[model samples]
Target: MAKKPEDKVLAQNKKANHDYFIEETIEAGIVLQGTEIKSIRNAKVQLKDAFIRIRNNEAWISNMHISPYEQGNRFNHDPLRSRKLLLHKKQISTLIGETKRDGYTIVPLKMYLKNGFAKVLIGVGKGKKEYDKRDVLKKKEAKRDMDRAFKERNQ
Candidate 1:
């Protein structure tokens, strides 16, 4: 599909990928106010400390910061308030079950807009052990060295 610039990423949680093994990700709608959307469009958002929580059979994003809109008055939404995520009932149930298990969680990977609507990329993730992260780092280093060697050989 063609990429939309307005949907051009507002924030990405790259640390989530490094710290956890993301099994699957789904595009979910976000409930936002007019000012929130405007702030997002301006790229005044932070997702580093953001996370997903399952509550009352639903998912909400917490700790995400969308700066205040320049044109907004008191009606502007709070920057760090919990925002509900729109997901299927089945998805929520599955997440709740998996999260109840050991070392599993729900995390937000990315945030963007889809067709003018705010959307979040939510993932069902399993936390990686220290050894797992080390192994991944080693693999990345090996790949980088291999690529360098291959480039010299080709030249």
Candidate 2:
């Protein structure tokens, strides 16, 4: 038996889960400039505030911040440029249909290097209300307390 190497996660949008209810996620390849890849290899990427947009039957990621490579100098790509996402026509259509719904949006969940190429996990999320956020937090706290009680009983 051989162990498989895991994909190296570069950046994650932690707030995505708290801000919206993720319905479905899709993995898509990203078009990156030369320097962008180098910056990602060093984990100099931020998925916070990043989102996906579908236009002209194409998927694009906007607001993803990939820091300038230290050695790139003039060759460094724009840190906040919109990058194309490589998804099939079927997937793009699915995203388009999903986003047409009220309060539904496409958000970037995670970015990582898979097989030496940069990929992003995008999700169709529906916005949550203020009360929804509070409910989630309370459930999390209750789970933590329950776990603590269970541990004490075992001890």
TM-score of each: 0.91, 0.95
- Residues 1-155, model 1: lDDT tens digits: 11333557888889998999988777888998778888888878888888899889889999999999988988788899999999889888887887898999888888887788778888889999999999999999999999999999999
Expressed as tens digits, the lDDT of each residue in 44-133 for candidate 2 is 999999988888999999999999999998999989999999998988998899999999999988888888988888889999999999
Runs of candidate 2 with Cα error greater than 4 angstroms are 1-5
Task: Candidate 1: list runs displaced more than 4 Å.
Answer: 1-7
How many pairs in model 2 have backbone atoms within 3 A of each other, for residues 3 or more apart or on separate chains, i.e. clashes?
0
Candidate 1 TM-score to native? 0.91
Query: Measured by C-alpha RMSD in angstroms, how accurate is candidate 2?
Result: 3.4
Highest-scoring model, lDDT: 2
